[model samples]
Target chain A: MRVALFITCLADQFFAESGVHAVKLLRSLGVEVEFPARQTCCGQPAYNAGYWNEARSMAEHTLDVFQDAEYVVLPSGSCTTMLRAFYPELFRERSSKFKQAEDLAGRTFELAEFIVKVLGVTKLGDGLRGRKVAYHHGCHALRELGIKQEPLALLANAGAELVDWPASQECCGFGGLFSVKLPEVSLSMADQKISTLPRADYLTSALAGCLLHLSGRMQNHRVGLETTSPYGLSEVRPLASLLWQAVEGAA
Target chain B: MKASPNNYPEEAALVIREHPEVRASVTGATLNFDQNRRKAYSEIDTEAWRVWAEAVKNHLLTHLDGYLRQAEASLVANGVQVHWAEDAEAAQQILARLVRENQVRTVVKAKSMLSEELGVNPLLESLGARVFETDLGEYIIQLENEPPSHIVGPAIHKNLEEIRQVFHRHFGTALNETPEALAAVARKRLRDAFLRAEMGISGANFLAADTGTIALIENEGNIRLSTSTPRIHVALVGIEKLVPRFSDLAVFLSLTARAATGQRLGTFVSLIQGPRKPGEHDGPEQVHVILVDNGRTSVLADPEAWETLRCVRCGACLNACPVYRQTGGHAYGYVYSGPIGAVLAPGLLGLEAAKALPYASSLCGACFEACPVRIPIPKLLLAWRSRAVEQGMTPRFEAAAIRAYAFTMTHPLLYRLAARFIRYLPDQVLDNRVVPVVKAWTEGRAGLKPSPKSFRELWESGEAQ
Candidate 1:
């Protein structure tokens, strides 16, 4: 399938490594990814800040850039949700724009959602060496995309033992601009999130932004646990070896 | 008069920051409430729950006038007086008239956000009636001369230490900073008021319009005592609180208890159909059901905004909201706070009064997900923002900005040019500068640093692919 990769501004700038991992993982899954050269930000920052017009412009830019793609996938759940769920509402009054927005939303999917729901890839060609992993379900993915079980399903298939946290669905306090806007509140909420993690070998989530925020707090507090995106874990083993090993084990 | 709601966000942010202990207490309490609610709701099928909840609410709202008429007739038949108040002033007058007619000197109130919304306590106090708040949380906030932070947990913003101080200052007794001790003190203080008060005033959680029944759900037994011991029991509720039938109560009752406190049922779900029976030993002689409209009709008229009235006021959304969890309920600046409050307050009290509230959310959909009655709170909030702008209630600059945005978005060339310009803007130019109207965005936070290379540049260079 020809896919338009919506590398959210967060991934493009801060977590470029996760973007690389996503590309590698997608290519391994036999997906051809296209980068729309004209795409800028998803306009979530502007939309969330109540700058609806600025956000609308950004949304329009995104729509114009990737209007022809067969499938639009994003690494970030929140941004993908913005495109697929909220962008239509942004253009509610304009019939032509609304149609475009609807079309974009209909085709767009979050990473795990695209993999599980669209691509039907339960078993990614990935392997992990017996690490007890806990999943941090980002608020947007859990609530908007409803991709709660898909990532966990993939992680389990990758041979990682999943341990559930008490409040796994809670926000990691990286509410994009909210982290800086409400710093103390953000830190406190992040503190609560980090504290909720069970003592596991590694913590993983689909959204790199949430992981970065949680990891910053964990590092500050000296929690001694590593955090990675699901793709990062998936890309560690070569596709041939991982698939062959899985086949051999199954036989 | 309280400061305009427009000034609330800044003041509330400052208040929350200054009082770290109160914020911590609210955060702790809300976190548990949120988690327990999730666990409880997960036990039930979500789709079925939504259908059941929606059916009950829709049935009630559709037949609201009919139900109110039936309830009034039933109450009157049972010898309880029914009064209709067009607004808060009329409601206050009705209460004052009741007090004068009965020659009532004291009034005991169970936790009522409606009363707070109407500023009822001060009005009653000015009329020479000694008003006492009966619910533990309500009593603490009452003593402190503050608004209830959370809908269900009235004094959710108060910690034990603050409660102890309020108790010490009010009762002139040394108090300890513990939940049990504070509850004991409040219980002791409120018991006398309940026993001697001539009138009991409480908010109705749900008015069973089918049978003229007022359902009061309380964890504390104070509501029961307050309603029973008084000579006159007055239940004031918004017109929207009516549920069409007694059977409909089952759905709401189940959703409310689990959604509010994570209990299978509250310790007490008192269903008072009317005034006490003639042979009844311990019940009020007169029961009055006061239906207060107070801007609800205006909200009801707007179909998009009307779903806010379906709120059970369970505080589930407040607990679930990331912004509310961080800033606490005070930031919303109304009697109702959190997601429901953000949507409802603007419609009820004009958009200008609550212009900032619609922007208070992260639009995370947690509020919608947590809502028991399935109110699309985030959608309503965004709709309110649009309405606010259309009504010329938003700041002129913001309206112009959005208009300019709408214009730019229609033109692809302009949009691309703007993006390129944004990319070229210096980090210093974008950094740490407070923009007009949206200073709320950068009040405590550093501004976004401009990107050296736009996503377009990287994409064009084949780096992002």
Candidate 2:
């Protein structure tokens, strides 16, 4: 299957490694991965901020870029959900663009959801062992994409114990630009989320934008937990390359 | 300290930011209200509530004219005068005439957003009649001379310390900063006004068209006193508050309390059809039902915006709104705030004044989910936005930007080039002088970084492979 990668702007700029891991993971599953370089931000920032025209521009760019791909996948659930869900509404009046947006949305999938549900690849050819990981479900992914269990299922397959994070679905207060616009409220919400995190070895989620906000706060607070995307954890080759390598090798 | 409705958004934003403590207090209060409301709704069978509520609302709306006539006839039969006000001015004149005819000097009122809509209190006071707000929350705001920030919790924006200060200044009484202590003082102060006032004015929660009954739901007991103590009781109600049957009350009764305060029922739900019976010991001598259209009929004509009339004024949507949480209800620059308020203010007030209300949401759909009557508030808000733009009510810069956007997005090559160019701009250039209009977006957020390569470039280059 030829899968087009929509490495969201956040992932491209800040979390490049997630992009590499996504490509690696898809290729490892015997899927042909195509990067659509014309793709930029999904226009969600513009759309949510009531800059509908800018968002429509971005949506149009995205739709045109991935026009030929059999399936469009993104590592960030929020961006994919934006593409799959909201873009159609943006172009509801313009018949041609509306149809295009609808078509693009219908074929788009969040990374784990596409892999586990569509591709049916639960266990990769490799695994990481002996790590207790807590999953932070991004609000859009949980509510919009409905990719709740697929990420967990893939984590379990990779041999990581999923630590239950209380209020995991609560927003980390990184509502795109909401953090800057309402910094005090955003910081307060983020602080509350940090308090809910149990002491775990690793924290992970698919959307890197959320991780950037969470990890930035964690760094500022000097909290001692390594944060990584699921793609980062899954793409660790040979199953025993890190601290859990010896455990995997012994097994 | 009159809150003139002019430049209200800027004023509200200033108020919200200037008093960080009030902002924090409203935020905390809203969070608690939201949680309690969620718990209350969850306890009930939501599906059942939705069906029943929708059925009752639809029935009322479809037969609105007939029901209004029936209610009028029934009230007349009960010897209660039913007066129709075509608009706010007419409503005010009718009310003022009634007050003058009786030579009423003092009038006490229960909490009523409808009265606020008509500016009834000030109008009556201007007519030389003293008007007192009897609800504890309303009384605090009336003393401070501000509008109710939250629909149901009128004083939700004021912290206990603020309330204590307001009470100390207005009532000349020393009271501690506790709910019970504060309530006692307000009750004592209002009980006299209720007893002495010859005319009572209250907002109706629901006016049963079939039974000609006006329903008043309150957690505080002032509404009952306001209705019963005065010799003449006048209930001012919006035309949209009418419901066809007494049976429909059960659905509204369930939804209103649960949605507003997360209680199975409010402390008091008073249904008054007319004045005192002959043998009645404590009841008003004359009951007047003033049905005020005041732009509601015009709103009903717009199919896209009419669902706003289904609102029960529960404030559940206000509590659940993200924007309302951060900025509080005041920032919406209207008596109504949150999702329902956004759609409502423009329809009732005019799009020119309330244009900002429509854009004040993330379209999270939480309000729609929270609405007991299942009003699709977010959709209506978006529709209002589109209408505002189409009507040239949006700012010129925003309109131009959207036009540029619509043009560029339809063309792929221009978009790709623009994306590539934007990626290379320095952070300083991107973050230069703040765009005051969109300061909400670029203020604290990570400035947008133009991607090094377009998704198309990467895809065409086979780098993705």
Candidate 3:
């Protein structure tokens, strides 16, 4: 199947390697992936900040850019949620874009979702064989899209030891503008989620924003993060890169 | 006077920096409540019950005016005097009139958040009546003259040491008194107030329209004494509390008890129709039910936010919220706090008083999950946020920046230009020391930096191929 990769602005700008890995992973699995060069954002940051006019403008732009794609996939669950769930709501008052929004939503999928559900591929060559991994579920992916078991099933079957952090379902507090607006509270939220995390080889998540918030805070807490008893954890990676490594069995 | 929620940033910062104990207490208490609530929900067909409850509340709200009139007629026919309050001041005036008419020198009260909203205690005290808070948690905060921090667990923000200190100052109780000892002391002290008080006040958990019945669910039996022992009893109910039929109590009460405190049933569930009959000698001589509006009608008038009326004030959303756990209730500077408060404060208090509240959450969607009535709280929060923006309540700089970002996103050329321009900026300009937003990020995380190459550039380079 041919697909258009709606590379979210965050993944495109700050974490481009993850997007590259995502493209390779899709191609290796036999699905052709095309990068939509004009796609800027799914309007999440603006929408989240209550700038609907601006968000709608950006969303309208995104609609025009990906109107003809068979399927549009993004590496970030948050942006995918914006495209899939909120776009229709955003366009509901306008009948013209409303149908367009629904059609776009129908074709949009987060990367992991497309792999496990559409590709029907759970195990990936034991690439992560024996590695301990703790996957953080971004709030939008877990709650908005109901994506809980897909990532876990893929990782476990790929020979990774999944460490179940109790607050896996909890938010990492990178709520777009919420991270910068209430930095202290945002930092505190990240602390609460990871303070008791179990020992792991890696901490990964489906969304780049969550990784940025948690990794940023983890950098500050380097002294105290793994200081004592449990919770000996290491560097943070986006889930796409991790999935790609697992599938390709790349060291 | 309402606090400016614009001060939320300073208040939240102060709590995070100076009030570590408050954060600790709130987090512990809320986590405990959340664990029990999740466990309770897991034991039942929670999804089915939530859908049923949502349908019932929606039906009531959709037909609210009719049900409210029906409730008033049924209440008056049941020999209970009914009063309507259009706002807080009106509600306070009604309470003042009642207290003055009855010459109520003392009052024993159940824990009523609505009473707190209307400042019932201070108003009664001003009119020469001594009001006693009989709920142990409410009594603690009452002695300290502080607003309740949580709807259900009012003293959740205070640790035991602070409570002990408050007691030592007022009751000369030993500073080292255990929790059980302190409770016994409060019970012993409140028993006198219940006997001598001429008036009692409570908040209705649910008012049944068909039977004109007031249903109150509480783990403490103080509600029973407050309603029965006093000659005058008054129930201040928000208009949203009405349920259609008496049997509807089965679904609501169960959901309320389980969600609020994880109890199969509260220790006492009082269903009072009216004053005592000629054959009956135990109930109150006069029963008053005041249906207070206080911005509720405006909320009801709202097309998007009226769904918040479905809330039972079970406080599950507060317990499940990460931001509420971090900053505590005082940070919001309002009567309510947490996820529900984020929406309700903006709706009830207006955008100016509560503009910052809606932005306080991470929009994690946990509150939506924890809601028993299935209120889509995050969606409502976004609705309020958009309204706030329309009202020009948000910051000017942020507004301009977001609009510019949107402008860039909408124009492919501008986005590419801006993207390329930012990529070439020196590391010093991108460092936390240089930018305020980055400075905030560096407070708990690493500094922000752009990748060396954009995704479009990677695609152009044929790196993946």
DockQ winner among the candidates? 3
lDDT of 3 by residue, B1-465 (tens): 244566787889889878989989999999999998988898899999999999999999999999999999999999999999999999999989999999899999999999989999889888988989999999999999888889999998999999999999998999999999999889998999999999999999999999999999998899999999999999999999999999999988988888988877788999999999789969999999999999998999999889999999999999999999998888888888889988998789887778888898889999999999999999988988888888888879889888888888888889899889987888766654557776777766766778888888889998866
Sort order, DockQ high to low: 3, 1, 2
lDDT of 3 by residue, A21-111 (tens): 8998899899988977788988898888888999999999999999999999989889999999999999998998999999999999998
DockQ of 2: 0.20
TM-score of chain A of each: 0.86, 0.87, 0.95
lDDT of 3 at B373: 98
* Worst-scoring 10-residue span by lDDT in model 1 chain B: B437-446
After the best TM-score superposition of candidate 1, give how far the Cα of residue B465 lies from its true spot, in angstroms.
6.9
What lDDT does each candidate get? 0.74, 0.75, 0.89
Q: Is the docking of candidate 2 incorrect, acceptable, medium or high quality?
A: incorrect
Tell me the lDDT of candidate 3: 0.89
Pairs that collide, model 1: none
**Model 3 alpha-carbon drift over 4 Å, by segment:** A221-232, B1-3
Candidate 1 lDDT by residue in tens digits, B322-352: 6676666766678888778888888899887
TM-score of each: 0.86, 0.84, 0.97
Each candidate: fraction of true contacts kept? 0.18, 0.12, 0.81
Return the TM-score for candidate 3, rounded to 2 decimals. 0.97
TM-score of 2: 0.84
Docking class of 3: medium
